[model samples]
Target: MKQRLIILSDLCGSEKSDWLIYYTHILNQKYDLVYYDSCQLGNVDTSSNDQQIIHQQFVEGGIRKAISQLIELEQNPIKILAFSIGGLIAWRYGLLTGNIKSLICISSTRLRKEVYKPKGEIELYFGEKDAYRPPMEWFINQNVKFEVIPNKHHEIYTEREFAEEFSLKLCNIQSH
Candidate 1:
């Protein structure tokens, strides 16, 4: 049987324009890839609530719910690949659930706080031009492994080739 791999999209739900297709394609070759859209996972009321609050609640609550569902699924040794704010959610889930084997976070921050601790191997990728680079002190203090791509941003994984390579790396890691 193929290993279970969970791919969390950006704050928005699955859109044809996003990197979901690329990552799913790569993992489909060797694993049972599951796509979780962050938007649909939580209660988002952007009409009246402050945008930041909506986003915060969405990330934190959505992650908690996702972790609960994953635990119920009883999939052993799950790996998570998350994008943008979804990465922060994954980090929080790792801290709370302790079920993730490895996590790949792309262009994500806001996980520097003490509340969000990663319990699994974390590979953080940020664009050199990303505006939201967490301070080096944060990574140093948290002891997280990170990498900076040459030119990209929150939507870097939209590129098919990059997503494929990233998914392959995750698969390889999962195999070991």
Candidate 2:
């Protein structure tokens, strides 16, 4: 009865980020929300091991695994909300298969390298301070809907205000 929303986590790999929480609060009444954490590796406290494991698990290989996991789940039209590396992974996967109904990629600067377009309604967000972000002209060239949040970074997903603002965007999007 409710729309299914799948949230893919960032390179940092926390599926329950503030953005997720904010969107859940706003859309829970109408959507079934699920969090998908990418293949997790070592703890952040152990820097070297964490870096090595994360790189090994969540690179190109992890994108395939994430897509497989999504398809391997129940067959349903899913809306996706992804961050950073997760956004790139989701974009890659979504392009391969038309499984997503809509997609929102937040701070997924690395997506610039990908040439395939997704089969769903797509929107992207970036922060001015994001070092890896694609130029605004690039988004315009690609004709992808995007917004640039002022004076923020890739970590804006964890910020309460940013989350709340993003939640509003999601709310407004589904209303039509």
Candidate 3:
């Protein structure tokens, strides 16, 4: 069976995008990858912008709702490749279900705010220039695996090849 992988939204999240579809096509050779953008997961106002979606997710019950939806969609253990706020959501779910095989989160700054260690092997990637990045000692102290990518926040995963390659490596996944 193909390994199951779930990707959550960024701060400026989207449930779907041409970019995501294109990337997943490349990844599908090895895993069953699912991408959920903000628009698809919540009871979002159709007109809401990225900022509004991000606010609704953290401020309201958006995070919890997303978890519930994920559980309903797949009961078996899965892997996660998430970004920003989506990383936060994926982190929460990993802790909640303990079914996460591997979790890879990029630029998830808010993770510094909360504290819940999940069962999965997780690796966090951050741009050296992102102010939100936690200190290196913190990861060492917490025993969390992480790395500092070359670029700043916006540019960290800008290159499609880099994003795709790095994400797969983090999960120890190989695509056909």
Candidate 4:
């Protein structure tokens, strides 16, 4: 049987997530995949394309609401591949539920605000050029494993090459 893997969308959610096919094409063969749109989960308005406006909503209360909704929806141990704001949500879910089998967060820059580390197997990937990404000291302080892809920017996960490489890595991890 295939393992269940939840994929959480970035802040822009499904509407702007055409890039998702890059990961799904490879991951689908190895895992039973589920997808969630962060905008819907967080009750954020997706009508506006302005990032600042969308982000403000999450900061106001969307994130908390989303976490509560997620807790209600999921009851079993989970593995997650989350991007951007979705990564933040997944991290909080791990902390709240303590039921994460594994978590992979990419370009989750908002994580810099978190003070506590969730209990689970976690890996964080960030682009070296992401100015908002947490500093190396943050990872060391949290005792979390992480990687920085040299010469890449915050949206590297949306790139086909990066997605393919990560999908392979994810497959290896699942096999082991």
Q: Write the per-residue lDDT of candidate 2 for residues 112-151, one digit (tens) a residue.
A: 7776677888999888898989876678777888888889
Cα lDDT computed for each candidate against the true fold: 0.69, 0.72, 0.70, 0.92
Ranking by TM-score: 4, 2, 3, 1
Candidate 3 differs from the real structure by a C-alpha RMSD in angstroms, to one decimal, of 3.1
Per-model TM-score versus the true fold: 0.78, 0.81, 0.81, 0.96
For candidate 2, the 10 contiguous residues with the lowest summed lDDT are 40-49
Q: What is the C-alpha lDDT profile of model 3 across 1-176, one tens digit per residue?
A: 88777877665556333356545766677777777774356444445566765566555877777667766765777788887777777777777788788888888877877656778788888988888887776787668888887756634654577677765764467845
Regions of model 1 farther than 4 Å from truth: 45-77, 114-116, 173-176
Q: Candidate 3 — what's its lDDT?
A: 0.70
The residue-by-residue lDDT of candidate 4 on 50-137, one tens digit each, is: 9999999998999998888888888889999999999999999989999789999999999998999788899999999999999988
- Count of residue pairs whose backbone atoms collide, per candidate: 0, 0, 2, 0
Model 1 C-alpha lDDT per residue in residues 10-114, reported as the tens digit of each score: 665564345577777667878788877665554444454354765666665765665565455534666888887677767766766686798888877556554
RMSD values for the candidates in order, in angstroms, are 4.2, 4.0, 3.1, 2.3
Clashing pairs in 2: none
Q: Give the distance in Å from residue 26's predicted Cα in candidate 2 to where it truly belongs.
A: 2.5
